[model samples]
Target: MKHIYTDLAVESKEIYNPEKKKEIEGVSVEVADEKNYSVTTVKVLNQKGSQKIRKPLGTYVTIDVPNLDKTDEDLKDEISIAFAKELKALIKEYKKNKILIIGLGNWNISSDSLGPKVIDKVLVTRQYFINYNKEFDETMANVAAISPGVMGLTGIETFDIVKGIVDKIQPDILIAVDALSSRKMDRISTTIQISDVGISPGSGVGNTRAGLTKETLGLPVIAIGIPTVVNAATMVNDTMDLIIHSMKEQAEIGSEFYSLLEGLSKEDKYKLIEEVLSPFMGNVIVTPKDIDVLIDDLSIIVANGLNIAIHPGIDIADVNRYIR
Candidate 1:
């Protein structure tokens, strides 16, 4: 209900691969880059029930999408379309189900609050769809949006806040959004992840609030997030990247390795080098001692990605052209 994101940048919207299929058979994870990026697929096999966590990539679409100078509104349009597409497939199985979009996290803490920023830009369609369908027939219409804030002096648990809303609305589906922590730093501002398993608000930190998952909410829950925060471990990872490149430049076998390395993402190359040079770094941490700005920008990117995923129809060109 509270609109939190400020310093709006409409032009930040970027669709790296418009031709890319919005939904794939499995989730694909990717790291951002100027040219090529890294994509990884995680398999979660021990899950049960009607709901399954489809892919680790579910939480990382925006990182794969290119372009950033976009406004919240533009990104919202993108997010809406993608959400609709995803829901459309789900609705075919459960026509009677209601849909709730919950944005999770605190609005005051900008870096840790991608959910609030995205919720602010979402275009509420429940009322609009109902009115539009009365005159013009349409097949879809049940949806709602909410942001379950982090526990503060309010003492409100995310589960209770979301549950209370769900009790009244009786939605069939719940899609929650929030900021996430990553093992890497460059990934901070470049990743958007989605999942059906819901999320535990503030879990990235030591504060693990009540979970808002499908099992608890008694609805099909989808979670969307971005890695707004990076752990100190990633700094160690980044340093290895530099060391490999430095070592490669000075070795006889370095030329061929350097050529292959140039084509690989910083993450992938780091992994390869790590396997070969495991003896050197027994255990270390090299990332920056500070993470304030990194987290701030990551939150914004995720907020924008959530908006874009739920409302993909927005025209960034129009906004950019008009603003200029």
Candidate 2:
């Protein structure tokens, strides 16, 4: 049984035994710690590196902005500029061609609405180019986007819908945006993970479906996502661990109850607690009470970054002017 499950590659590193895994050649990791945000870049080299890291052999860039939940426009602009820089590096090779952006989620759910919300704020130039034909600025990419509602609502596979669009547009690259699930509650709406390896649509929330990746789409796919919810079981386990540690510090060393709690192996403790809570809260997901506010701020931040990345002539100021 897996001890922990996380969609974030950085978190996966925390669980694996460092002694058993050697640093593969060509794989690189760099971190930038700033006052407002932290950026972790994981570049997987060969297939061997991918296996060692349990991630696709591509670049995974994660930006953690702790104050995202709080309304901080100046900090938001900083993050947006930083995030756009990272995106430009990843898609620099395909700047001369069309780009398709897919917003994957159920808009009716507040936590899941991040992708669609971002789509709403993006500056779509595809229609203008088609209708005008060389009238608009040549620097602007032929950028198009869609918010394909979730499988339950549309009664269609997300992959199938995306594949149809890909076949028609044949974009040089695809950028997919979706809400993700993280093991820690604090990451919800606060962390953005961008990967050249693409994404698994429903897999983030434990519903594994056909993924949207380079292998499936036959083109380079970039995925951008934010952790919007966390597993309920993990929430309970973390709380119990804190309680057990507190009890251990306060209680005598040989106290039976304290000893019992401390003696249970991590795996066994998780199993025991999971079984006890399974009847009521199996596969439960927890989100913040202020998710609506968080989503609004994050959507603008992400959309602004995309606008700057897709349009070479536009700056953060230009994006803000157009968006407002």
Candidate 3:
């Protein structure tokens, strides 16, 4: 089978069962359709499920908004509210505890800048809590945020930096945000994945880093990611599939060309495409032309959701008033 590259568990599940017919052995999936978006939850129950999906044993919630790239203020607000609802469910136990938000990515590149951009918009109140030494309200939480640059710029592993902060602050919960890679073009910037399995920084781009997980950090780690790029080979393979389907439609039922097209397995085709492109492209990545605007909009959407989820006192209106 072709090694499908995707940072989404839902996509991995789909790749496991393209027909979406029968159930996997140890995996459970539930999907819900909301007003403007859809939510798909994939839970890897044990080692069996983990091996099948190539994902850690945890809950991965995917939010798909078709119009995310072209969203207006109203749609952004709606998406943020939906995001907050899902995020709130995951961290309900630590709502009032000290929380740390780590934005993991390079801010210099627009396609890889989702994390840092979100940090700029997120509401940080940890300093205020420390200075005054009192809770302003029952809904308030001590929230701190940081955007740790990549190793190339700082000469330090992201995990080391995060571990140092975690040791010092001793937060009850940690949330890490980063950009991801998708196998499909339409999913880029239109999908948000919230998982309890934590994250491996730069893994989507083949730059795997040490993961920030419960075992490594000694706390519950939540990961929120948005797909900002897609592999060029995957995109070309999809286009070839479409072209083959179109050609097959015009061919006679019993024609040799039809049979040949039908017999071409996705794995074989993808491998052939990869072989053809590898020399020149060398793992080329493709992102939308309007990535700057997409990054800007997505950052606000994620930040607003984090604010509303972490700070119970905040809402869409409150976040908008401050962020916008």
Stretches of candidate 3 off by over 4 Å are 253-255
lDDT of 2: 0.82
Worst 10 residues of 1 by lDDT: 6-15
Runs of candidate 2 exceeding 4 Å displacement = 17-27, 46-49, 135-138, 255-269
Select the stronger candidate by TM-score from 1 and 2: 2
- Candidate-wise lDDT, in order: 0.50, 0.82, 0.90
Error of 3 at 251 (Å): 2.1
- The whole-model C-alpha lDDT of candidate 1 against the native structure comes to 0.50
Give the winner by lDDT: 2 or 3: 3
Using lDDT, give the best candidate's number: 3
Weakest lDDT window of 10 consecutive positions for candidate 3: 254-263
lDDT (tens digit, per residue) of candidate 2 on 1-324:
545546787665543433426545546778899888899987888877666556777888999988877888888889889899989988887543688999989999998998999999888888888888754475688889999898899999999999999999788899999888887777888899898888887775668788899899999899999899887777776788788878878877556787788666555666777788889888778899989988999999899999888888888999877783
Q: After superposition, how far is residue 152 of candidate 1 from its true place, in Å?
A: 1.3
Better of 2 and 3 by TM-score: 3
Instruction: Tell me the tens digit of each residue's lDDT in model 1 across 19-73.
Output: 3445222333333243323223222333221112212212223323332222344
Q: Per-prediction TM-score, please?
A: 0.57, 0.90, 0.96
Residue-wise lDDT of candidate 3 within 272-304, one digit each (tens)?
A: 898999999978999999999999999999999
